[model samples]
Target: MNRTNLCIRMLQLLKARGKMNTTQLADALEVNPRNIREFKKELVLAGYNVEEVKGRYGGYILNDQYDLPVTIFSDEEKDALVQSYKFMRTQKDFKPLTLYCDAMDKIIATSKISSNASLHYMSNSIELDKKISSMIDKTQQAMNHGICVVLSYQSLKDETPIEFEVEPYEIIHYHKSYYLIGFSLLRKDYRMYRFSSERMFKCDISTRHFIHDNHFHLSNYIGEHSLIPLDLKHVIVRVYHKENGLRLFKEKYWGNKLLPIHKEDDYTDFEFYTDDMSNLYQSLFSMMDQVKLLSPDDVRETYLNRVEKIINAYKG
Candidate 1:
């Protein structure tokens, strides 16, 4: 069979069933196993990554997202864009979070979401998984049809093969990640699940109608730590030593919002803040010694108290 027919048939098969390995695909395509290998090379040549799974549960997965370049700008251009966005989000007076989202939507509407968005934010950390290409396509179709969808989520709260019958509402692509915002049947509340790290996905339409009178906006339902809420302004952090805690600070942030104030007495100060104390603490604790809260007594006290507990816990 021609590769075109083969791909079409395979797409249908995958839509019906979540995933299929090399052997299954080769057999279904009615070609020699060796030909299957050649076909995959051809697919890659045509801009697709035929992913190979290793170990017991490993199999051949089609990565359609990587099939082609979907953006007008090059890699450097996109990185600069993300950096600028990070600054806008974390700035002291970044108003109209929705505008940011809207602007991003417009900027990325026609472009490829894969290359532009960074699903994993872990800097230099060996932690990331390439999301299945078919999953997002199926999700888009499901969302368009207003059907129930399933998710295999492992983040923040739910961490299992969650069979969620959800009414798909919106697709949020922020912080170099894509999320599906919807109403969950199990929780009976709104939740946003990341498209990445999704082990598997399947969707079906239900005859039942969703109660959509008092719609809880996605912007409000998001966590406080997010730049959307925009409560706390900015803070000025003064470092003691010039090269002190620099690594920790950079590792914590992407070097967008935290700007250098000055270097003093072998110490330097950077300015950045957020309403989410936990995020703030994470950013601060990474700067083991050189980091200090120059202003905002409350934030300083919280850090000191945590330090006290640590000290008491490890008393000599």
Candidate 2:
């Protein structure tokens, strides 16, 4: 009901109906003549191209066409979407914001879910830490300001659990777990610690705050690096087929980088790189005849050694 909003809404009315006079605009907006005149000038300044007549029957009109779309979101629904994805039930993914937006289009289109609408599912599809999600959300804000995190943690080497101060660098979700990537004061190095395993977590004053990078976004961190053990190298295996698989790759990976390297009706090579070759190794064993380790000799040997161990076990 704000006068400014009403004035803006008047354009939508005029776009629907051919034109509207200053009197009608005033009546619609429930404002005075001076207000309507001011609104008209404001609209003109906003590139509305307004025209007006001076006579008694004279009225204001739009000199140009309006093509912009008018869209609205219900307050409750917007709140729900924000709540669902903001934290706890957060939709924070390893995908970049740009990539996330692209994925959101696909997610909304395929899932038939509204972008700003609340998510309510009959069947549970997501599993994670609710409290930890909230904490992580806070951690992101704190990371921007170079704050420290004090969380209850248990180490495998230690018999009892302890709370320690650590600088929150990033949060990476992988293999059904949420890990906080950061430099620990006690450990004095970059460490990946589990959030769910923590009994309690909060910021401590004794610890130092350090902003790692403006582009030190956690989503990209997860997408680029996550779920792999230390000292593992990423080996991208590209597979090319004559047809069909490129579309599948685009659909699955949702990127042009992998798809452009392969073409339709041409031999398409499938390429993916991984240091933790356990999954790839097993896959290689199954596709022994079709799949080839096109990259490093060591990568191929790692697969061979696993097969050798299996053969040795079978013989023994």
Q: Return the top candidate by lDDT.
A: 1
In model 1, pairs of residues that clash are: 47-67, 118-176, 240-267, 241-266, 241-267, 242-266, 242-267
What local lDDT does model 2 show for residue 289?
A: 48
lDDT agreement with native, every candidate: 0.57, 0.53
Over 97-127, each residue of candidate 2 has an lDDT whose tens digit, in order, gives 5554444333333342333232222223456
Write down the TM-score for model 1.
0.41
- Give the distance in Å from residue 310's predicted Cα in candidate 2 to where it truly belongs: 6.1
Q: What value does the lDDT take at residue 79 in candidate 1? A: 65
Residue-by-residue lDDT tens digits, candidate 1, 1-316: 6778886676566556655776787788887666655665556557654554433455556544432345697777766675565444333345776576545544543354321233212123332343444566556666544456666556555566666576666555545455666777677666677666454444445554332212233445443355245556477786665463665556665223668888766667777656566567776777667677776776688788998898999996
Quote the positional error of residue 187 for candidate 1 in Å: 3.1
Worst 10 residues of 2 by lDDT: 115-124
